[model samples]
Target: MELAKEIAKGAEEEGAEVRIKRVRETLPQELQSRIPLDKVEDIPEVTLEDMKWADGFAIGSPTRYGNIAGALKTFLDTTAVLWKDNLLYGKPVTFFTEASTIHGGHETTILTMSTYAYHFGMVIVPVGYGIPELFQTTTGGGPYGATHLGSKEELDEMERKIARFQGKRIAEVAKKLKS
Candidate 1:
């Protein structure tokens, strides 16, 4: 999604290595194989190995009734091995979500996902109020990380701007923690 890319952009600008992953699609043949999706090599499937290799995380999903998407839930569920190994312990993490409307569970999704981070002993990195966008934004984003509204595949000016703030924040935190 545009918001996801925006967050990555934010981190990349701060010198963080960015990799994008998507949960395995369980959609039907037609829905899953759309033209753009046919290029699967560009966006690799999210794997536990990817989790193991990262210093930090920014997980985003489409809200499903104030909760995370089942696809993402399923992906996370497979990380039992990581949890047991403490593979992600104390790593920084953040989240973002999208919905069709303003109140479409962005906060809840980001907040709820933090429990998973907690389970892994990861540090929760909220976007926080340091960014002016948090105080003045009329669209997505809150104390949680970057957020976006609308069905567009790309972020608008506000969402992109705020996402940059989130990306920089995450990069700073992850950089410090990594050192």
Candidate 2:
């Protein structure tokens, strides 16, 4: 959630209105009670209308077996109506992710998520070494998109920088597209 906030911060800095929403949790009540979700409890669950309202998107998720998490995937799978209606076509979109290990599929998660953008005909805006942090960060951030390592609550400086850059870049692109 912190990483999403950083991305939203960058977008807001770039003059884009942002709304942060989380996919609905799919875990059983018993399992959900054990995990800490206080940070996101107040975040509204994302809806099809929100998806239609945004000019662009910065979708974030935690890696699940080197792919997009099931909760996010389930939410995305419900977008066929939008897809059929062509609501997301030509809009810019970016991706971010978190992983438990260095090789825990950060890039793969982003890459897999990009498939959604492709299907929706949204322009994929990747980081592409646009910032020094991408090259320097030992922990997270990459050409695919902003990323973070481990399940820590706080992002490292480099991770935050890269996420901000991605947010700003996407907002700029979306603005240009709008104009």
Candidate 3:
């Protein structure tokens, strides 16, 4: 959700109202090293409900073994009920991912996340325009979306810009779709 937070912050700056929330996921012990324990536990039931209510969404997760973390996957798997009702249809959605090592299956993780959006009939928004920082910056983000550089401290100014840009882009798309 870091990317979403960036977007939301940017949207706010642009005089766009934005609401951002996180969905809680259940995870096995093996995955604990990959995600913050507090984040995993503090998730609330309202997150999913909020997802249904939002005009658009930016979903993010850490990559694991060339795919999205099991925790995030588990949370998404629960959305089958939402899918059955076709509630997510027409929503503008985008995804972002982080990984421990460079080349750690970032694309695979994004693809896996994208699959859920596809099933929900949501429009997948790409980061179309290339941000200069993506190729020049030392830390996170690329054409995919805002991403972390595997460590907390690695998230620098460039990452922040990319995150905000991604969020603003999604919000813009959501606004367009809504209109």
- For lDDT, the strongest prediction is 2
**Clashing residue pairs found in predicted model 1:** none
State the displacement of the C-alpha of residue 129, model 2, in Å, after optimal TM-score superposition. Answer: 0.8
Residue 175 lDDT in candidate 1? 97
TM-score (all chains, Cα) for each model: 0.90, 0.96, 0.84
Q: What is candidate 1's TM-score against the reference?
A: 0.90
C-alpha lDDT (0 to 100) for residue 11 of candidate 3: 65
Q: How many backbone clashes does candidate 1 have?
A: 0
Model 3 deviation from the true structure expressed as Cα RMSD, one decimal place: 2.6
* Candidate 2 lDDT over residue span 10-114, tens digit each: 999999999999999887888888656787999999999999999999999988889998889899999999999999999999999999888999989999999
Residue 143 deviation, candidate 3, in Å?
A: 1.4
Ranking by TM-score: 2, 1, 3
lDDT of each: 0.83, 0.91, 0.74
Report each candidate's C-alpha RMSD, comma-separated, in the order given: 2.4, 1.1, 2.6
**Best-to-worst lDDT order:** 2, 1, 3
The model with the greater lDDT, 1 or 3, is: 1
lDDT of 2: 0.91
- In terms of lDDT, the poorest run of 10 residues in model 2 is 27-36
Model 2 lDDT, residue 123, Cα: 96
